[model samples]
Target: MSRAGCSACVRAQEQLAQILADYDLRLAVVDVDQLAEQGDPLPRAEFGDRLPVIVLNGVEHGYWEVDEKRLRADLDALR
Candidate 1:
């Protein structure tokens, strides 16, 4: 997920962790600024502006916040 120092990202991360506790999932946190420093080129354009993004199976979910109900449903469907 694209996340910076956003409180929403923190909450989302916690919620998602709780939701997926039953399953074996991998969560990767990529710092936008750090990525740019490493020559990511268009960091903001790529994900900086879109902090708190969720990528489900390589699909861009969205930004802003996390929906607990929706997340649970998605997880259920995956199983």
Candidate 2:
């Protein structure tokens, strides 16, 4: 989950983009603010405090930043 104008979120997305292709993974960026405007505020309510929440495989992997080393390890394990 993320929000507009979040520097951390932009950085996280850039970081993910750099590696996702290596693992044949696709990223889906969910804007919490957009969700709220669309009548679904659960994500924002649950993780509003965390601007750049990283969710991998439907489970939250981390927040604030993208732990590339850890994430790469997790992706390898998935294989």
Candidate 3:
């Protein structure tokens, strides 16, 4: 997730934790301003303007306010 101290990111993290309780998924919080500290070779401009981006299976899911019901159904289908 590309977050920058946004309140929406905090809320989304809480909601996602509840929804992903049974899944073996991991949530990595990537601070857009601190990527360089983590040795990320990519440039921040790629996601600078878009904070709270959710990545699922290495694909961009979307920004904040994820569809909980739809995501649950997708996870169920994955099973």
Candidate 4:
């Protein structure tokens, strides 16, 4: 998940882009504020304060930053 104008979110996305393809992974960037405006406030409520939340396989992996090392390990385990 992410929010508009969030620098951390941008950085996280960039980091993911660099590595996801190597692991055959895909990323879905959800804007928390947009969810709230659409009346589905769960994501914003659950993670509003933490912009740039990274979720892998429906499980939250990290927030504020992309932990590439740990994420790569998790992806490896999934295979």
**RMSD of each candidate relative to the true structure:** 2.0, 0.8, 2.2, 0.8
Model 4, which residues run further than 4 Å from truth? Answer: none
Model 3 C-alpha RMSD vs. true structure (Å) is 2.2
Report the alpha-carbon TM-score of model 3 versus the true structure. Answer: 0.75
Cα lDDT, all candidates: 0.71, 0.91, 0.72, 0.91
Clashing residue pairs in candidate 2 are none
Query: Where in model 1 is the C-alpha error above 4 Å?
Result: none
Full-model lDDT, candidate 3 = 0.72
lDDT of 3 by residue, 8-78 (tens): 88888887777787687656777766875677736366666666776677777677677788777877888
Model 4, TM vs. native: 0.94
Over 13-74, each residue of candidate 1 has an lDDT whose tens digit, in order, gives: 88767767667775676666777778875755676676788767767666767777777688
**Candidate 2 to truth, TM:** 0.94
lDDT of 4 by residue, 1-79 (tens): 9999999999999899888989776778999999899999999999999888999889899998888899999989999
44-78 per-residue lDDT for model 2 (tens digits): 99898987999988999999989999999999999
TM-score per candidate, chains pooled:
0.75, 0.94, 0.75, 0.94
The weakest ten consecutive residues by lDDT in model 2 span 18-27
